[model samples]
Target: MVSGLLWPIIKKTGPLLMLLGLAAGGYWLNRHYREILTPDIALGERLYQQGVDGGGHALQGVTQNDIAFDDAQFNCAQCHRRSGFGSSEGGNYVLPVTGTILFKPRTFERADLFNKLFKESQGQVFRARMRSAYQRPAYSDESLARAIREGVDPSGRQLSPLMPRYRLNDTDMAALIAYLHQLSIRNDPGVDEQTVYLATVVGPNVDSADKTAMLATMREFVEWLNLETQGNLDHPNFSPGYRSDFAKAFRLWRHEVWELPADPRQWPTELASRYRRQPVFAFIGGMVNGDWTPIHDFCEASRIPCLFPFTDLPPTGHTNRYSMYFNQGLILEAKAMGRFLRAQKDPETRTVVNIHSGEPRSSQPAKTLTQSLHGDKRYLVVDLTFESIEQLRDQWQKLARQQSAPIQAVIWPGTFDKTIAAELPLLARYAERLLLPSPALEANQTRFPADIAGKLYFSYPYELPTAYHPHAFRVRAWMNTRDLAIENQRLQFNTYYALNLLQFGLEHVVDHFSRDYLLEYIENEAENQLNPGTFPRLSLGPGQRFASKGAYIVQLVNNDQRQIHPVGDWIIP
Candidate 1:
């Protein structure tokens, strides 16, 4: 009788167990579905930042305070590490939030929070569940937030016993959001304001009587600057439209000093005293035409860099406060030429003829052509000599006649003696030439008609600031640079790359005018902070960067037409 009674009790207990199991199962399914669909704002941020701008953490710059969340951890960097904040309770290395799991919420976004909750797998990552919580859905975002700060949920549901709400104040919440918003920033150090100032080199060029007065005025300006802005090189907190009356007067004075006649005495001393209180700054540079060593030495002693031809100068290691913004030696010119030639390929013309100037390797001159030349190949070796260029052309013509080769083109370097052209008849039609590579020739870029100059290319001795595209190069012509021939597709490709290197450096190293304006600008960096378009204009090529070492190559159409190009242009072996 006892056994029979036990069986009935066992049967009743089995039904109760089934009812409990089904309830538990239903709750889990709802929770899982919620987590998968509405993921979070952080997911979107991760995708946008990591993929765009070529990879890095995404920052919405949204701080915990922006959304009015109260937690010292709103920076999202502090808590669950990398900010997803979910830890598994059970499966593999699991410990879950012990409290209430509210549905997920998309944190830190202007969009409807619901849309940002789910994380969509990119590529195969979507298909495989892996360790990702994306499929299972994250912890109920609201429940989690409540659990962290308050021990209870919106429904007064007690959450993981481990968490207790520590009420936070309003001030702390605002600060948190502010910090997050601040964090989501792009760290691009673009060129600061295009500052302008006068640099004068006082010499015999100045009047003796005016010199003492000028010196006194300049020192005063220095004193004024020292007192004004605290010498910060970065942007000072000045509003956009403030009138720089004092600075304008100085800039106007700059034009006077820069364009000063051979004799400073020709100008009135009073005007000079009023604006020329700044230091005497010299334009130091190098080119083949003059002795540039002293200027080079002065600039080097000052650590100023220049994009000069491939010459090596040492650090100042000196007492001179001056510096040079450098232009590397002739190598920059050569590399620029290579980029120009590589861009100009047509199927019919596979051969490249680089006629550079160098000492003859043998007792007699021989053509040194790039061995890489192949297909549609052709080359011409025109040796340089004092004899009229006609003599050299006469010889080339004779050879051309014997070989029946259609002497396609001619490229000449400035390093050659132009008088040699009196002999060669083929180079007279230089304007019709297709390719000229050199900083100097390119300086006169726009003048060369792009229509006639097929596949023409050139490099700025110094490129523009952050010149990511060719539009900057097209604008360079307006900066008084020689207009370049954008002969169809070739120019569209090469000018931008060449421009990126040169222009960026020029703009970067020469941000300031001379040291005195710098000192004053520093003192008034806040007061005198110029916009990106401000003076010292950073203009290149309009004036021969006579101070910077630069060179160029020009092409001459192989014709008997009557105008010759610059000397020492390239010829093949």
Candidate 2:
């Protein structure tokens, strides 16, 4: 009787248990298979950043805020950066969307809230501003969607007036949430437990003295940095200003020298091969007299950070993330000269002659100037290979006679020699309007003659020497103590400045070692705050490849003194 009564109950409950088990198994399989198909995090990131859908379609969103944005101007990453860290715009701060912030409990002071949301908080654990903005509980997926769609917080409080209410479907919204869950969680290469590897690149045509000087400064800087951070590297102690998690992020600097081949074409291949063997976190300072385009391309392709190269002819117009230059180098000089030539008092005399030795490095400025003219034939290029004083004089004379009209101006993009001093006084008789780069002339200062002091106008790219002294005094003293010969003042100062800037930037970066973040930090913050080195004022911004944007047209003053006074305003060409 007991068995018969229990049998019915067992049969009924057994089927129910089996059904529940099968349902749970089916759900797990569906989830596992869905992950294989949709890579939710990556898909969401693509949709958020690129405004693209899973099927390679351009995803769109509509916003009904200040201005109705029915178009793709509603990209999530545009306002809330790729890291899901929101930004301040037009007096309003956008809320962060990262899962770490969105799904966590809140107990943070208002003062520390801003830092936490931006990932800039150091040694302070704080809740995100978004989470602290209301008295509501943690956000559920449903509430998050409602917040995004209705421009309201989880606490039923309205968002800022500038906040755009986005319209996203369930699938897209889920993907974005998944992406936010994993944002900024992956570890980047080029850094290890004990070392942060860097590479310094050099071109085939770099001057031996300059190459030596650059390498020496770089090596010494690395040594000094390692020594200063020795305790941190070994025992892992976070400084007062740094985040505790970044205690072990400090590492010994290990650098490698990469020398590119004489053939520009081989640089990409060589850099690729070298990188394959030993990848680097960043490139410090590079020197190249010839084309840097190949190296620039390599850096962009390989996604390596390249800081201020000693090259004038940097590739332009294309967008870049990895490379930053001191200035257009010689190209800025040419543009300044071009503007000077265009502003000449004599409009009738349109023909300006550019005299350069046939060397590739010297010819670059003229090419840049000619290109800047943009089909305006007022400027003329003349390649005169002068081996001796007689040859230079002969070429100068020939050019003087060859001009159909009074020459508007003459530009010598190459270095000045002792021979040029004698020729300049004579040449001044024919061409009173002469343009010479101050850098080229400064090297041969002793050789410069008294007679032609006031005659030639120089394209001065830096601040006056006296002005540079104040900013460069400490650096100069340091170099002197090290007994490093000041063979090239600009090169030494630039190298020193680059290293210092990199160090300061790395301090701010802490454990975030993204190459893009490093570049962004340098471009946005370091460029503005750092003391001016050889440059009068150095600055870089989003999409700006060059640091120094303007040049001065100044005339030399005092007989044989090399003193100069501004001829015109600082011109940005």
Candidate 3:
């Protein structure tokens, strides 16, 4: 049995004599299973975090002033963090204890080290900046142990008052040292010297034109990037002065299209099948009309990053870790409308009716709006299932005539056709009460009667069209150059923005293709500079999913036939 295992190991690594004779043999084993060397490393890790000892007792530490701190009061990770790359809170800077930082034969200024660590955190907010003039020397095992136990640095200087001196026995100290030696030493998956594989999911029901436009946008961008970096595509070292020095060689981007089924239950299996073929580094620029929960759950389960898909409803709350959205489409509109309703002087005295055609895509917003305004009085839902436009008009007329109290708002969450727009004149009695989502109004813009223009208020998630004209012109010019049609402007624009954001983020990440690192780079760097797109502004922070946080409640200004302007300041809801 021993011979069989040794035979394979010898065959893969080298001859038996070479394995036995070379110093690299030990290095190879250490690199392969560095964390598995001893149980002490795992125990030390737990102890560092929970202050638990080898005997399952809480480990305590003492401050320089001789004040005792229990496990709850003092944990190593609280200051040093899990990877031993320290933290900053307020003006206090913690020292790094990772083996690479400690044993290296160099010194780093406090500001330089903190800058490296800040980038490591991927631009997370709330972490304070380093402001001290302190410097640290390379450390040996004895000096590191002294720093932990006696509050003295390798340079014989006293540590900061914030650092607690631990009362660790020799064995525990050795274990802790061993654990620190292996921290942040392993390489994550989905990256290599040759290529970085990426994927985008397309829901089966996504419109063919939108699908074509989104895929084209991504493919064209990837093609352009590869062409620009062709010099380093297969070279051992990337050219100097590139955006990221971390990437030594140009890693070609390979794209995969994972087309998901309409039935959400089948999405898991489909995704698994595609992933099994070849795992991707991340997912970007997907399009879906209905719920994105299935994709969101898959990304979370697999710990893969899914960024900026063209969908309105995304998973809400702060719990999701892997999926990011442009905005909470219809859900955002509902919230904005709710804020408007709440501000009305006598909203309780007026009836608020949400009108939809009973389709989930249309009704979902109404449902969400009703849920948001659940506690408020005089809120009602009207589901319209008419086969003809005349029937819709007759019903609207009847509702218009039957209203005893004033209708504060008559919300239409679904897209409106010309027939509906033509019938708007008959319901002019409730004209000023009309409220529609931006998409619905955009769809019916040409058909809407001039009389209803001033009376209608729209929930605009992006900058007004005039404000976005410059970006629109640029996008069109680029598309014209590529011989691509300006079909599905919304999808094309969002797709283009997503690709730009991805490229900007990838440049910052350099060669670090870990999914979490990709997200961190975007969260830190893209907020203030996401431009040449349609949104007024796009931003992300820790626990934030939506890039665009606020919406404009605008009414037609009447200066021109189709001109619209914001009624008030942007509202974040």
Candidate 4:
């Protein structure tokens, strides 16, 4: 009786156990297949971006007309872009290769069709001219491989001749396909269905007025953007016969302020904590008195864009992809000074003195100039550090007494006050030329001593005041209408420009809402006309982090009038 009872129970459980065994075996087989097919994604990234294979060799491709090209000349990023979202240029539309766009079946809904037609015709095209929606099946791995090597789509249609045929081996092709499958598949943080969030960074020890101006301008712009978006949504003007597709792109803007700690060491912790609580899509119109390295590093590590911070001391070295600056800051000014001194036709033997207060803002440029002219036999570089105006005066007197050759002095007092301004004219008598950064003179233009106007020169990184910038009037009118005070023009104008640039970049991405896509748009489509007359021209391109590339060495002319005039053309060093 016991054996019979056990036998019945075993019969009931035998089928369940067999089914579980099959399921486990199936899962193992699937995983094994995935492991076999999936190659290293980094190799694929290099192939897509740098056009290099896993073996450190340049990948090769062929055009439809049998023209061969190497990776250096024809990389995927050159056309499809770093985001893999593709772009339209020179009358050709490059199809997006991101996994989100590629792996799914291709079919346009009625709204999407209308939007495309409306965009292409600028809202003038009629429905009678509409064509049937094109359709294609979802791409399988084998189909995608064929498409890459043979220029054929999953629907057996030949791709455009502009699409090059790559000669990727089995392993390399799998890696490239895997990379494409992973490209921009998920939405970045700080974006939702109806709103996108952004932040502005404020570093420690910044002037209260400047900080206020930057924040006010950005906040006002965000408020205006939300109001406009609401208006568009309320009056979408969508009809059965004619649809307003542009209304779909409207999203409310949410702005946040991130104030960094006074201690630089705690910046990363603070930034990470704030980001964890509430992430932002990008940073716009930041202001700091000192170096921007800490903030820049945070942005880079987080893969967030930091746009156009106001500072005279940006980090030096290789160009950073995530951080875009207005210019190279004091480094540019120092290089310009070096170029000016080298171009001078004065006596071969000369003494160049670089004096500062040992602060990064002051000492960094001095160091840059000294390093730039290190091996030159034409002149001798003397670096001097002073803590007070009295100490600087004593050093100046001692230098004047011992100087044998003509003296060219570049002084950065670190803090430009009335006391320093008063002492600059007296110190200028001892040097053939006394150089200063434009920011120093601009900060104290009202109390600037006219006696030093003749001997003093400035490294100017902006358009001369005499040139007409009609856009400045627009900026002023916008500020006046908003009831915002113009305490700091440079700060306010740059802040306004950064906001406008973010707005422009967002407009291009529409519903995509990818940080990489936004950055790519900024790199390629930043308009010069958007500049608010703070700089001569503001623009950017791929791999370019600095918008302004040159500076002018200027002199304060017409001492009675107190006008700043350029000594020569702009110098790009």
| Model 4 / residue 460 / CA error / Å | 1.2
Q: What would the per-residue lDDT of candidate 4 be over residues 1-573, giving only the tens digit for each residue? A: 559769888798989989999999999999999887768898889899888887888878898798887765577888888888876544355677889778999755444343234443332223332453567798888999999889999999987788889998999988888899999887788888788888888888888987887888887888888998888788788543433555656789888888888898998999999999999888887877788888899999999999988888888784487888889998999998998888888756889998888778888888998987777788899877898888888988997789888888888766653356678777778887888887777666564565667788888998887777888899999999999999988779888888888887887676777788888778765654778888888888777889998899988776545577888888989
By TM-score: ranked, best first: 4, 2, 3, 1
Identify the leading candidate in terms of TM-score. Answer: 4
Per-residue alpha-carbon lDDT of model 3 for 429-493, expressed as tens digits? 66357777877666664646666666678888887767744556776777788787767777778
lDDT at 145 for candidate 1? 48
lDDT of 3: 0.70
Off by over 4 Å in 2: 1-65, 70-78, 82-148, 152-162, 168-183, 233-246, 356-363, 371-399, 402-404, 412-429, 443-446, 468-471, 480-485, 558-561
Worst 10 residues of 3 by lDDT: 122-131
Clashing pairs in 3: 238-248, 312-329
Q: Write the per-residue lDDT of candidate 1 for residues 1-573, one digit (tens) a residue.
A: 559868988787988989889999989998988775443335333332231111232222222323333333332322222212222212211111212212332122212111112322234422232333322233444444444455554455554333323333332323322222323132112122332333323333333434433333333333444344333222232432322211221211121122333443442342244334542323311222212244445444443332222122222233323333233323334444443344444444332334333422110111212322322133432333323344545554454445332333334443333332332224423222334334334223224433444434433343332235434444334322323233322222222222233322222222223232222112212112111211112222211222234433444343233123433333111
Candidate 2 residue-wise lDDT, 470-512, digit = tens: 5577888877887777777878789988888888666655565
* lDDT to native, each model: 0.32, 0.70, 0.70, 0.81
Instruction: Mark the regions of model 3 whose C-alpha exceeds 4 Å error after superposition.
Output: 1-184, 233-249, 346-348, 357-359, 374-402, 410-432, 468-485, 488-490, 557-562
- Give all TM-scores, in the order shown: 0.28, 0.77, 0.72, 0.87
Model 1: how far is 56 from its true place, Å? 37
Superior candidate under TM-score, 2 versus 3: 2
lDDT of 1 at 234: 29
State residue 357's C-alpha deviation in candidate 1, in Å. Answer: 6.3
Report the Cα lDDT for candidate 2: 0.70
